[model samples]
Target: MWQFFHKLGSPKWFYGIATRFMPWLLASGLLLLVAGIVWGLAFAPKDYLQGNSYRIIFIHVPAAFLAQSIYIMMAFSAVVTLVWRMKLADVFVKAVAPVGLVFTFLSLFTGAVWGKPTWGTWWVWDARLTSMLILLFLYGGVIALDRAINDEKSAARAVAVLVLVGVVNIPIIKYSVDWWNTLHQPATFKLTEKPSMAVEMWVPLVLAILGLYLLFGWLACLRMKTEILIREQRTRWVRDLVLAGGK
Candidate 1:
């Protein structure tokens, strides 16, 4: 296990592995996403109360889940980079930021859309909503910090430290609904209890979440490969690979 983890520290090896994995990940992600959309939008039974408005969960829940998960992933990568000085970890951090930001924005937008019909308002200062907005800013801040520094290593270290510090907000975001009386609904999916939703409703939601995770994985690998190529352009292996491709 330790050896496998250490091996992933190598940018060249990671780039090669990611190249091989990209096609399968991309295909699987697209399949799952399309299936989820079809099931959620058309086949799933309407909510007894919310009616068609509940269909927004197909987008809203998955994006919200990814928004938080990506930050945790970023923080974990930061820890790895700080503790082990792994360069590939730095790439992962940079690769994931923009994706996380986009997902966070999607979550917020879908939440607002879902809100108008259910909550009777499009916006609110609720704890869950506010924390999610802050998460988007956090992602943006990390991306900006990465671009601000002249030295890549210095920038990576700086953003790693910031990410570690900002990780405190993750738990706050997770428990916000439980801690406060908020307009936002409590968690829909829980591991310990049987899902409150019917099979038709829950299945599509689960599929959507899995699809988004796979899609994020595909994008992160692609972005990391791009970062590797850019940073390793002067290397003999990269040079040879590029020249060979021209043949």
Candidate 2:
């Protein structure tokens, strides 16, 4: 296990391994996303209350899920950096921050779009929405901090501390609906309880979530590989790989 963990910290090893999986991840993710969009938009029954506008959840839910999930992943990477002093850990944080930021923005944007019809307003300061907005700012903070420091080690340590502190906001966002009366509805999907939605309504959502998760992995790997190349540019192995690939 230690050996495996150590290998994961090796940028060269991960880069080589990741290159082999990209094609499969890309193909599967794209296919699942297309299938989910089609099923949710065209075939799923219209909501009795909100009608077709609710279909936006198919996209919003997945993006929101990804937005939240990627932060937890980043937090874990931060821990790895602090405990194990793994260089790859910070690379993961660096590569993932921008992608996570985009997803966070997408979730907020889609939520507002979904809200205009359902809540009769385009914006609100509800707990969940507000917490998510803060989450986006956290991502931006990490990115800004990373860019501000010249020394990579110093920058990484600072970002890791910031990420660790921001993790407290995640559970607040998750449970905000329960903790306070709010315009945003409670979770439609729950682990401890049967989903509030019918099977037809939920199946496509599951697909969208799965597809988005897979795509996130692919995107993270793509970005990490680029970082590896940039960080390892002066190394002989990177030069050799480039030369070999050029032949």
Candidate 3:
């Protein structure tokens, strides 16, 4: 297990592995997303309470899940970078941030849209809602901090520290609805308990969530590959790749 982890520390090895994995991830992710969306939109039964408006949850919940999952992943990577000084960990943190930001933004936007119909307002300061908003800002801040520093190693170190600190908000965002009185509803799915949703309703949601996670995996690979090429442009492997492409 430790050996496998150690192997992942090598940029060239990971880049080569990621190159092999990217096509499968991308192809399956796109197909699953298309199928999930079409199934949810066309076949899933309407919410008796929220009606068609609830359909937005198909997009919203998955985005929210990814928003939080990506943060935790970054925080873990930060720990790896800080303790082990792994360059690949920094690369993962940098590559994962923008995708997390987009998903966080999507979650907030979809929540607002979902809220307007349910709560008769576009915005609110309820605990869960406010915490999710803060999560978005945290993601944005990490990305900004990374780009703001001119020195790559310094920027990565700085971002890693910030990520470790900001990780506290992830659980806050997650449990806010449970811990406080809020307009936002409790989670539809849970790890320990049976899902509150019916089989038909949740099946597509499961697909959406899986598809989004795979999509993020695919995006992360693309971003990591781009970052690797940029950082390793003068390295032998990169030069060989370019030469191979030209042949």
TM-score of 1: 0.97
Candidate 2 ranges beyond 4 A from true positions: none
The sequence of per-residue lDDT tens digits that candidate 2 reaches over residues 146-241 is 999999999999999999999999999999999988899889897688899989989998888888888988999999999888898999999999
Cα-based TM-score, every candidate = 0.97, 0.98, 0.97
Clashing pairs for model 2 are none
Model 1, span 1-247: residue lDDT tens: 9988988987778878888888888898889988998999999999999999999998899998999999999999999998999989999999989999999999999999999999999999989999988998999999999999989989999999999988888998889999999999888988788988899999999888899899999999989989888999999988988888821
Candidate 1: pairs in clash: none
Worst 10 residues of 2 by lDDT: 238-247
Clashes of 3: 0
Per-candidate local distance difference test: 0.91, 0.92, 0.89
lDDT of 3: 0.89
Error of 3 at 62 (Å): 0.5
Candidates by TM-score, descending order: 2, 1, 3
Superposition TM-score, candidate 3 onto the true structure:
0.97
